[model samples]
Target: MLDQLCHILLLVVVSILYHVTFFLPPSWVSVLRISVLLLCAAKPVSVMFTELFGRFRPMPGEGTEGAGKVIGYLERLILVILMVVGEYGVIGWIIAAKTFARSRQLADSQAFCEYFLVGTLLSILSSISLYLVLYRW
Candidate 1:
């Protein structure tokens, strides 16, 4: 139980840092840890979705099936939101939530722009990949 809680806490931290930094937690150790967390989060969600919807089983077997559908769709939608949120989230995490060009909150302007650009590019690429992954079979 405690171990699970710690894992959850680590996920929250990693996700939080994901937006703030492209290759978050720069150290090799931190990067590896974060990568593991991301893999952990993503794998379960995808597997559970596939299992519940196994072989076109959109709602899965039973038990928490209904709840899973609701939560799964909601979660997929939230993932899209988070993708966009990372746009300003990174900037805000560094600057202020009210950050803008006019705000003059460009502390790490160069680094921020670089990271933001890469993030945006990766976002588009990932969206396309996500579409193909979900629909193309």
Candidate 2:
């Protein structure tokens, strides 16, 4: 209980410092908000996908769980940042770059490709929806 309280206190302090130090515009504020939301949602989303993909469309090899979760969180953060800055084109490039990097591995495995695509799509959709909700431009 004490550890949890300290951790929560630390998180609050850090979040306050981050907001105070950053010179974010209104839309960028939404980005920050969405990033936090994504961070919290990452694990639940991963579990949901694990059930959907792992059961229905199982990939052959086991992935590094922590790394994948961190990567997805970072990916959502980047997408939110890009959207807030109106760099919609960069989002496509980001996706393309990911595809290029994974092309060789994905080429040999349809199940892996499906898993990757579904996760990417979910991240993109969540980022876009958050942006639209906050800054309906």
Candidate 3:
């Protein structure tokens, strides 16, 4: 409970700082924006899952939690990059690939399906939201 609160607080602080990057030098803006985006996609999203679904335990033959975290980080980063480059159509392919990869597990367990769906949606939404906030502000 307390840990979740801390994560939420940290996310809020980073979001506030994200806005401040606009005041920085133009050369630093891109780097800082990417850095902040990655930061938001990482721990905060994991914390969000924890809060929403409780602890996630992968079924047998599934990858470890750390691997899932890394994958989520990479997934969100890639989505953000795609958005920045205005490749919105490609986003569907990425989501489709992910869903296909997890198809067996998603079909096997109801809980896993819900977790994957919510996590994927949250990740995608967060990436889009972050991009809009940073670039459109």
Candidate that scores best on lDDT:
3
Candidate 3: pairs in clash? none
Per-residue lDDT of model 3, residues 1-137, tens digit only: 79779877877876686679778898787787777777776777767766776666446465665676677888998898888789999999999998998899889898788878877998988889888987897
> Looking at model 1, which ten-residue stretch has the lowest summed lDDT?
94-103
lDDT of 1 at 58: 24
Give the runs in model 2 whose Cα sits over 4 Å from its true position.
Answer: 1-48, 51-54, 60-65
Error in Å for residue 37 of model 2: 5.4
lDDT of 2 by residue, 1-137 (tens): 67557657856974785667467676766566655555534554565566666665544465564665677777877887788688999999988887887788689888778777888898788778767865574
CA deviation > 4 Å runs, candidate 3? 1-24, 55-65
Better of 1 and 3 by TM-score: 3
TM-score of every model versus the real structure: 0.26, 0.63, 0.74
**lDDT of the structure predicted as candidate 3:** 0.79
Better of 1 and 2 by lDDT: 2
Superposed by TM-score, candidate 2 places the C-alpha of residue 99 at a distance from the truth, in angstroms, of: 1.0
Clashing pairs in 1: 52-60, 53-57
Q: What lDDT does each candidate get?
A: 0.43, 0.70, 0.79
Best by TM-score: 3
Clashes of each: 2, 0, 0
